[model samples]
Target: METCSIARIIRLQDLAMYRHKLCSLLFRLLPQLQGFPPGPPLKKLCKDEHVHVALTETKMVGTLPELPQDILMVIFAALEIPDLVRAGSVCSSWHSAYARLCNLGQYKQSQTPCLVYASESDPDNVLCLYSLAEKRSYKLTLPQPPIRSRYLIGSSHGWLVTVDERSEMYLLNPITCEQIALPSVTTIEHVKSIFDEYGDVCKYEISWHTGTRSSRKPPSIFALAELRGRLQWKAFVFPDTSTGSYIVVLIHNPQAQLSFAKAGDDKWTWLPPHYLYEDCIYKDDILYAVNIKGELHAFDLSGPVITMKTIITIPEHYDCDSRYIVQAPWGSLLLVFRIVHDHDLEPQPGASEYWNTSEIKICELDALWTKIKVINCLRDHVLFLGHNRSQCLSVNEFPALKENHSYFTDDNFLWTVGHTNNHRDMGILNLDDNNMEEILSPQLCSNCPAPMWITPDLRKMNLMGSMSQQP
Candidate 1:
């Protein structure tokens, strides 16, 4: 009984307070009920509908009081450097957010993850570098006007390796705007020596059927120089007839062989005769030289002689046309290349039908070197396998498509330039569940830029053997 009485009294008190103002005004004007107690009656009149109206209006405006700058800075500092800068232009309250973003020392030890250099088929060909962890994009200012170079060879640390149309090499730190000139090679003497060895150097023809070529002069070699953080150039005649000598021996085309140059007080050294038949890739502490006979050889930087162990010898019948190899997620290496189109595929003459055919293969490098047939995409194919996918192309054959490839986390999410017959755009192959989503879409760049290699973070780079380099 007592609880019920208390609850009833509370409700009555609220009602009376709500009615107090109007009731008092009525009583005063009318000179009636003047004997009523003002205080108690006013408390009863407080439950007015106007109170609800005022409360609702206040909530409509999303007004969060300005937090102190110190608190804002603390919150912003937790964000990645790029996110904080992006928030700066939002409003004055966010200005403090921007200030805390440039805490540069916090990122010094991390090696800035991987630096990404991006360019398109624009007339100006603007090159930009992005730090994956910082999520910040810095435009690369070329030392002079932009050159006609459209290919990126590789990147080490913050330095970007690139080559031009005529095979001129240049290295640049997109972050510091520093450039280094690299020795360029127009032709290989080993390739010429291979022909000389086979007696195919005389007046002959380059026939596709017999893989024949005429006598040709040896290739020219250039010495690379980096001075005062600026690039300079010098030319030197190779096959130095003096004390320094490099030899060439060809096993395949007799046109492509190996050349090794003697290291004479200079840091740069090449093995001659530089064999043209063998293709090489450097990773970790070892350099891999694979000959045309499907023989894999390893040369150690710490040791004087190459290892005698047979790393891998692929069978010719299995197709050994892989042009690129990368270390995969784990310790296994990935070899990438296309399977030759079946010559039996005869075109339908006078028919408007177009045939799409290609076979992309992947081989894992380990003790046994396991091979897995990974994917088959349409049109001319290029493959990138890694986190962020920012290395160089397997081969620097295409100029405009030097830095144009983008890889997302999802599987079979393939995006490439000119993967279709249409020249105006690019295509994507989403093979998540074996169902291919062939999306033919337009690109944002004017020049149909090809996808370049992605440089992953330090941890991933270490996985892909980016920690060491040839001195």
Candidate 2:
């Protein structure tokens, strides 16, 4: 009974507060409706059966009967995006006040990294977002008949690079449920499509070349579903801020070849010097790629002819599943490595299908790449690594995030090789003290796809839509 009274009192307080806020907003409504700079006496206060406004010479008064916040939200939701934009301008304090009702609140979302994974119990069209701020999962439905099975090769900015069963690559905005189709794998330089008797594309023939175009390795035939796993490894996107144009860079298989294309391009342009690239990042109008052996190369793409330069190479000795190249919060390049040991988790003795991870060793390098500088602390920042584009975020901006720690997901190729629940390979590593902070239980993520970290971004969704409409 005591708790019920407290809850009732809190509800009454909220009702009064929201009522006061709405009454204040009424003063600005007329100015906004007139499309003027705003400063007008309401002129007259009149009461009507329905919500309306009028003016009298003696005294201008605007009146609004008190309504529940939920009822107000229902009314606000009836207004479209344009109306919401105007309504939001009435008061700066209303920017995030009851944010969900404010469609503009999406633009103000905290840039916290959320985990995108599947739910065992939900339909295939639905996915779950494990938000770090709330520490809870929410259901998000994708536009689909149903995604039988999909693979996410990369996440950048706020978009996810996803491949469907037909081996077609496309950009997906999980927040807005917008999808943009990319050039087909058939348009790639070395991949050709093969059609069946009914003229349906059945398989793709992929090849790699050496000195001359005539001299090349044997071509391999892969069905549509199997092609993405073999052909595409990771994808990165760079969107032009001014033009809203964007480019997607792909690090593919067969010695980690490189290919890129603009959003409206018809085909992929193959970049030269196919090194075994483990990770790549774009910063300061330059592209930096790192190989498995820890060699960094910079690409110049501004001129008519693209040029590449080898920056520096470090001799790596530790065993690791993957190496990532990321830009620091201070705008410097850093090479990070997570050393891990795998254990066979298969029920059968000889099966190598299921693998689990055990250890971690985070390493950094000097500017020259000749000296190994083991970073012990991240000070007010948190690092997110794995399938998502590697990033460093300030703890000051995200108070719930662990300071001086790296949150990673399962990027083990072994887990992707076949069907297995190895999502247990994800956890947070405390770089300050060099200890494993937490590893999620296998049961919590058993039904999902390989877990990936996607930084929540709503502003990019608008840019994505505009880019797709480009000529």
Candidate 3:
């Protein structure tokens, strides 16, 4: 019995030494396996060679360390804004990299234009940002300016210019939830104050027409202006705001008179009124506008006193309904003309009272304003047209977008019916072949605000306080 016990003891010692060496080898190979559960003492594990083998395999297959920061940044930079934001949530290192990229403006290069539509579920405050590349919609909620009574009049440089029922103006960055209030409505030249019996301003009236009226009460001019047709306010923001300097131009009332305010102004300063201004755009630090007569004028905001110069006159055309001025991505200015025909003013059986868009005309303006030419083909570019803002984008940057198309939404003439059912009005217009087709078939509820295109930008802006207070 003593001889047998001695032989068993020797064998057990050999097994223990083997197990110790095996574990040592694994730890050397994988430094990441340091915190792994320690195996049973060799004496306890001597009978189970299978467990020893299993542990060895497990330690050898340990997970790899996280990717390096520089390498992660390169990968994240290529991702779209929404995806990049999600990646930042993975860990602290990734979030730091995202912040650095935003500060450096690296993410701006990866952004493609997105169609911003009012959300059907929460149309008042929530907006749906639809990505053409990803074929998805992201819901965004506004934090300020009380979107319920506000109207989005302009979108540019990632900011929306909104006006409320009280004619209060606000600049809001939907992405960052930043807001800046512009000059007040009482500051406008055309607004007349109506006081109460106590000598307090109770209401305000906009003196749209100054001339004498007919004997008849003119078909309830207020309702006609609100429903059928009336001039709408349009605003344009200067491209550069790095030095805390920016200008906003407003086309006021049905007369389309021009007024402007600077960064520190407390009131809007009226410029020499122009005749029947239709649309305005800001390009190359200058404001360009078009009138009902299709005349283009450039307003210079460089000096304390703003100056206006007539640039070019659009060739005369019949049944002209509306005009829009847009700046192309390549710095070219374009005039989009909407022609309407009212052959049958009366509605027939099952007929709707919507104006038919007979034709669309595009024209390019020369830099010197000496020449204007009609353009039928938009080479590698797509135009987004609507009431809020009109913009042109190049397809070379957005490979998923179709080239040479014009996407349109509802305007005053087509507002009687919702955009979803008005297939004849809102859709993509093939500039190459002059064909119109439906792009979105959303089941939007009636009276939903029309969608607009907004180019996502992350640049920081100098935001003042709310409308009731100054910065």
**Largest lDDT belongs to which candidate?**
2
lDDT of each: 0.34, 0.64, 0.60
**Model 2 lDDT vs. the true structure?**
0.64
TM, every model: 0.44, 0.73, 0.72
Model 2 poorest ten-residue lDDT run: 47-56
Whole-model lDDT, model 3:
0.60
What CA RMSD would you report for each candidate? 20.3, 11.4, 15.4
Give the CA lDDT, 0 to 100, for residue 206 in model 1.
19
**Mind giving the per-residue lDDT tens digits that candidate 3 earns over 335-375?**
88876663344668887555555567788888876777888
Candidate 1, lDDT over the whole model? 0.34
Q: What is the TM-score of candidate 2?
A: 0.73
lDDT of 1 by residue, 1-471 (tens): 354345334434553344333322322322122233444333322221111100111121122234456544544444433333333433455554443433332222223233243335433445544444333444434544363233343343444445444334455544334555543332322211123466643222211111234345443322221110111111111122232221111122233333232322222333323233334444443555555566666655435654434477665534633334454333455554433342222446753322222334445555466444343331232334321222223223322221223222111111121121222211222222222222212243222122222332111112112223211
TM-score of 1: 0.44
